[model samples]
Every structure is written in C-alpha cells, then in structure tokens.
Target: MTFENPAREEIKKILERADNVAVVGLSDNPERTSYMVAQAMQARGYRIIPVNPNADEILGEKSYPTLKDIPESIDIVNVFRRSEHTPPIAQEAVEAGAKVLWLQLGIANEEAAQIAESGGLTVIMDRCIKVEDAITGPLKK
Candidate 1:
C-alpha cells in the first residue's frame, strides 16, 4: 500500500524548521548530481553535512563516512544512493533521530519510506531538494 504524505503546508513547516541536513552518498566530484544538489541547497542557506566514505571533504564541509558518524542532530537525510541502498540509510536516519528522509529525484524506495514514516520521520521521495526549494520559495518561520 502506498502512503500519502503530509500536506505541502506541513512539508514547508518542516523545511523551514530544519537547519542541519545530512546528505547521504554525496560525492566530491562537482559534476555529479549529488554534488550539484548539495551546492544548490548550501546556496539556499541550509547547513549541508556531506556523508560519503570516499571523501574527507566536499564543498568546503567535512565529509563523514556514514550517517552515524555525523555528531550533530540531522533534520533531514537527503539520500543520493540507489533505492536498494536506502533502507539501511533510512534506518540510520531513524537511529540518528532525523525528522525527514528525502529520496532524491529518480530514486524511490517504498519500503524505506514506510520504515521512515513508521519511525515518525517525514518521507519525501522522487523529489529534488533544489527544485522544491526554488518552487516553494524560501522557507518561512
């Protein structure tokens, strides 16, 4: 069964309240989609924490090897990995007490979304953070 997500108003509320974002599977290569999206979000005034085992830093922020390695509380877990890899990441997001689990464009895992939602996290799938931000205007308090 597919779960209908929270309304746009609630999503906007969460986005506005979120300050720290953990970008899972982010890459150092500027040409990659993950890097480009991260750059865009950062430009939009969000604190982006890069999570990648392959890099020490990306876009001037220290990169963690995994979500668990990120010390601070994360408001959103922006997943850049494939659908098959998402359940574990979703679990990590839950364990880390994240409020949102965002699956980037072209990536969706219903099971992961269910798990995240079951764990009380807001789930956003098959969406681009940058596009959403641009279309929704700046997040309001």
Candidate 2:
C-alpha cells in the first residue's frame, strides 16, 4: 500500500511541538525556495539549521554537511531535495533522532516515506511546512 501522510490535527501538533527544523538541501541563495521558506520559518521562531554541503552558514545558523553531522537534537528534518535523493536523508534523519521528516512541495518518495515511518518519524510529504504553519497560525489568534 502507498504511504499516507498525517492528517491536519497531527500536523498542527507537530508544528506546535517542534522547536528546531533542520533544512536539508537548503540554499544560501536568496532567490531559492528553500532559503525563502527557511528564512520565513526562522523569522517565525523555529530554529533553522542549514544542511547544505556547500554553504557554511545560512540565515545566521551554522551549516552542516549532513543530517548526521548535526550535534544538537532535531525536532524536524525539512527536506528540499528531489524525491530520488530523499530516502537516504530519511534514514539519516532517523539516525540523527529527528521527530519528523517533512518534504517540500512537489516532492514525494514512497521509499523515503516508508523508511521515515518505520523509523518512528512523523512524515509529511509534498507539502510545504511553511504553508501549513501559515494555515494553522490563524487558529492561535
């Protein structure tokens, strides 16, 4: 059976509980979607850890080459990578002990979803975390 993502109730809870978000495939370029999303989330209070091979920093946070390289606890693994590149990141997110594996818009990898699910991670696929946060923000008011 194809992996199904979590419902809105669970998604809201994940956002409410998560304090740190590790952005995989994050880009330093201001024009990039990853950068924009990460920047917005960072501005909204969630700590953004830049996980990119080339950059040493993004949005004032130190960058790491891989998920396994992050020394601190990760509340979420937010991926901007292609579907094909996501399965390994999913595995590494589990190894790194992240609570959630979140895929950006238009990205969906069944294998990665399965891996994350088996690793006990709450997986959100083909959806923008920033968008979800925006949708749920009004409820807090």
Candidate 3:
C-alpha cells in the first residue's frame, strides 16, 4: 500500500509546536522555489536554517553543508532535494535529532519516509511547509 501522510489535525499540531526548520537543499538564489518557501516560513517566525554547501549564507542565516552539520536541535527538516536523494537526508535528519522530516512539494520517496518513520521522526512527503502553516494559521496558545 502507498504511504499516506499524517492526518490534518496531526500536521497542524506539528506546525503549531515546532520552531526551527532546517531547509535541506536550500538555494541562495531568490529565484529558486526553496528560497521563496524558506523566506515565507522565516517571515512566519519559523527559524530557517539554510542547508546548502555552495553558499556561505542565504536570507542572512548561516548555511550548513548538511543536516548533520547543524549544531542545534532541529524541530523540522524541510527538504528540497529530488526523490532519489531523500533517503540519505532522512537518515541525517534522524541522526541530527530532528522531530520531523518534510519533503517539499513534488518530492515523495517511500523509502525515505519509511526510514524517518522507523527512526521516530514524523514524515511529511510532497507537502509545502509554508503552505501548511498558512492553512493552519497561528497557534491559539
């Protein structure tokens, strides 16, 4: 059977409670979708950690070459890489102690989801994190 993401209520809970989001495969270019999405999340008060090897910084945040390179606790790991490249990212996110693994729109990898799920990290595949937060609105607390 194909994998179905968590229920909407569950996703909303995750969005409401999380803070820092490490954007894997994030791009420094303003024209890229990753940059735009990450910016939107940053505007909404979610700390956006740029995870790109090529850039020293993006959106004024220090960019790490890999998820494992991030020193702090990662609440969410939003991925922008291709489907074929997601499994390793999932592993790194698990190793980095991330609470969630979010694969950006158009990226869905069952193996990666399995890895994350087995590692105790919540998995959101083929969904936009920024859009989810917009839909869920601000937390009531």
Compose the digit string of candidate 3's lDDT tens values, residues 2-69.
89999989999999889889999999999999999998888888889999999999999999999889
Write one digit per residue (lDDT tens) for candidate 2, span 97-139: 9999999999999999999999999899999999999887642
Q: Rate the local accuracy (lDDT) of all candidates.
A: 0.89, 0.93, 0.92
Q: How far is candidate 3 from the true structure (C-alpha RMSD, Å)?
A: 1.6
Off by more than 4 A, model 1: 139-141
Q: For candidate 1, lDDT tens digit of each residue in 1-141?
A: 976666677767767888898999998999999999999889888999999998999989999998899999999999999999999999989999999999999999999998898899999988888887777677432
Clashes of each: 0, 0, 0
Candidate 3: the clashing residue pairs are none
The segments of candidate 2 whose C-alpha lies over 4 angstroms from its true place after superposition are 138-141
